[model samples]
Target chain A: MNADFLLKIDALSVSFGGVKALENYKLSLPPSRILGIIGPNGAGKTTLFNVLTGFIRPDSGHIHFNGQEITRWEPYQIARLGISRSFQNICLFGKLSVLDNVIVSCQIHERTSFLSALSKTRAYKKNEKALREKAWKLLCVFGLEKHADRRAMTLAYGDQRRLEIARALATAPKLLIIDEPAAGMNPNETQDLLDLILKLKEKFNLTIVLIEHNMNLVMQLCEYIQVLNYGRLAAEGLPLEIQQNQEVIDAYLGDTNNAGSN
Target chain B: MNKNKHALYLMISMGLFFCAVYLLDAYGNHYYQRVSNLMMIYVILTVSLNLSNGIVGISSLGQIGFMSIGAYVSAILTLPPGLKEHWLTGLPHWMSTIQSGLFPAMILAGILAAAIAFLVGIVILRLQGVFAAVTTLGFLIIVKVVAENWMTVTRGGRGISSLPTYTNLWWTSAVAVITVYVVLRIIRSPYGRSMLAVREHDLAAQSIGINAPRIRLLAFVISAFFTAVAGALWANLIGVVSPGSFYLWLTLLIIIMMVVGGMGSVTGSVFSAIGFTILLELLRGFENKIAVYGISSIIFAIVFMLVIIFHPDGVMGDREFSWDWFKRITPLF
Candidate 1:
């Protein structure tokens, strides 16, 4: 019931046929804060995101966004309410041009009717021009302007990741959730992505909730952090506190350390 | 500035197309004129089907159903009241007394077909891939069965014939031009972009606020409207309406044209429809000389197999024929 919180989830639970994917998950996020959800593989990090974005219906829960209950809203409705996300796997419109990928996201806010588009009315033309310019500017931000006309699938791996983020940003979302933005990046590219995320947060005044396996990026970027283990909230605190919490380290961070050593 | 330049090029192309059609109408033999008219109708069918199957990535096998609905609706409406009363004695008083011009009948036919598509799409568009394709094929069978059994309205399998020959080269060409223009405009618009996104990845599209089901339904309904209009034109041109004509064979012909032309390319669909129609006519001539039955179908099947083997993405592969391509090739010539 906190009026200042931008997103509130309470008593959220979802289950597959016999196994729980998420159980009694809760989050209260204030505006303009970066929250990181870190967990081991199969720890339900993505399942939580799926529920929050309305891609999956919770078995039992309540979600309030901007003071409106959106527990049962459709994915597009949730997105239009100013929540946008990038996928864990790269999911660009493979056959569409790089510019077109962003333009399609920008089109969520388009006001012209199909009739106007068919007739090429002045309003439709102006709106279309504005959308194109906005998409082009976004591509420019990602250093993709040179490849705007190329199909998205033709881009190199890192560029495709950047384009996904650019496409997500084009929706003008208040809450941006990116999953594993540094998954396949080299150290140099990861550094650039870290800087880009910080810059975008400042430029758009965004509330970002990201799920990352890269601990260094998570620790540097997140103001608050939550840890999940076996579909339950294992720890929630400031980044420094979560880094030192014994249960979280034993449940998740220890695995990363062991892997690094090996 | 570039947008205006492209528009100018489109206008010039349309102008040249009409001039060519006019020359054929004035000087070509009746046989060639009729074949060209049929080609225009197939062009409309192929392009409209491409919107659903190619661009939206929804494989629909029910286009012939909508076409049949269009054909029957237009035929019943435009048939002279005296002829209707004499031929179809089971018609209701209101239906038997009504006689309309070709234009209004065709428009009504399209509207009716779109309405049916809207209802049907709500239920079936939820299915994806081959399931959706099979459901649409079932829809075609249902429509065919209804037409065959509804003796009062459709006169059953015998069909309505010889009432009028209202379709000509002008009507067919004008409608075909409008179909191409409208589909092209749609492909460049926001809605078109959404459709393409949904086709690429449904989850990604939904994440970005593109309503996947709604976008798919829009494509289906618009495609059905145009297909229905083409059906109306075909019925008027041939001066007959039969359930048998709107079945699997006709569906296969239109689908072949779409597949060979490249599913997602509008220009590909147009050229392929024209190319295939002419090829079929030439094959028919050969069939007549050899006294062979079903030889044209066999040849086309082989041609389709060859195209699939060598050029699986069709002639266009989601790319349009741009003026730049024309310029690039001019040097080689």
Candidate 2:
């Protein structure tokens, strides 16, 4: 309760083509903490992410970030307000180098002055210099300095996941939202990803939020868990409470032997 | 391996290139100067189109619409009543304050072009992918229709004439150089990257903090502005204007320039601008055929298909032919 809450959503709702995707939903999130969201396929989990991140415009709701109302602010505005995200599908620019992919985040660091742009001033060059260094450092931090100049698409699946995290981290956000970071990874890769997340959370003092179907990773990694079913907030509490919460079990994992539940 | 060294060398080469151009123009005949002038304006036009066509991945066939605004606006602003008296023969009231100078008129025309583009960009950039390109084409048709119907200003079918031609080789080349620099700087900026990301993956860019629609709109308007300036210079060069000057043929010719040079590469655009200018000159055999839009359409199709097939990367590929890249590829050459 004493933790600094970074994001708070109130009664968020959205409809896509007459299908009510998200109904009245509300949640408050704290900083420097890991929040896990789990739900069935159509339970509006991604929709919730979209609404909070400015992708989906809620019909009736408010999104507050750091105590300021950011309900209707644009995506870039929300980003510049110190929010960053990784996609469910790894979204690195396949054509560009890993270095260039991360450097694109540098665009956020400086506001791309019109005068410097039109006239090609020295300030533009200085900004590029700073960006190049920052991009390199971020890549290095992810143990990817050796592969800086390689095409992003050429990276191994695990490296690609790490690269995505690195690119997101380049935004220098106070809060980081990752969608399925451990997705499509082998056990070794998932462990590596989990370790990287821990290392990064400590290093950047980052508040992390993610959507994960990997309950093992979710329960182990997340401090707080929110479960959704049918676009409603079914449960919100610590990880153990979510584990025992019967409704969460029915929606997320369903009635089973919990084979991957180990 | 320092990229800064390459940047420094490029700066030096540009300065030298300017000096060379100054010497040649200062001493050479008018004919050579005129060829250079044509190249300069084409450079501006083609490179600007690349902003939308290449960077944003929008193939705008309506580039001529924005160009027409610049040409007509510049012509009306600069052409004296004595000169344009026949063209504006049936002028309405309260039209006497119009000036007949070149630079002021060109500047005013550029601003007006951008303002109009800004407004139109709002409606036009609302579209996406192929629909966006198609809507802009429709926009060009609308501009053409307006210019033809507004007979008092655009001279309808006969077109406006007797404009004070103030565009010289020096001015055109300088504007071309600066325009390239301006566009390059823009493409390198965050807005440019966001626009590129929108082209690459719109949903991804959006989730990562880019507002795709707004970024696309900015590129669209800026592209329109520079395209209009090129048209203004073009009007000055020809010393005449006609509603028929911009049409399907002209649009095809401009598209050919951008595509043949490589869609988004600034280097490709400049090279293709010059190459396409020269190609157009060679197509002088089809000057008569161009009136019916035949020659340009054929040329555009052939060039576009060829580039898309054999030279998908355009003339320079995606890489620029800078001193550094040149040196890197020198061994192969």
Strongest candidate by DockQ: 1
Give each model a TM-score.
0.97, 0.89
In the range B1-333, model 1's lDDT, one tens digit per residue, is 766877788789889989989999899898988999999999999999999999998989999999999999889988989889887777888989998777888899999999999999999999999999999999999999988989878988989887587888889999999999899999999889999999999999999998899999999999999999999998899989999999998899999999999989999999999999999999999999999989988998999999989999998878887866755768531
Model 1 lDDT tens row, A1-262: 6789999999999999989999899999999999999999999999998988999999998999989899999999999999999989999999999999999999887766878989999988898899999999988888999999999999999999999999999999999999999998888889999999999999988999999999999999999999998899999999999988989989888755567676
Candidates in order: C-alpha RMSD to true structure: 1.9, 3.7
**Residue pairs in clash, model 1:** none
Chain B TM-score (model 1 vs. true structure): 0.96
State the fnat of model 2.
0.49
TM-score (chain A only) for the predictions, listed in order: 0.96, 0.92
What's the interface RMS deviation of candidate 1? 0.7
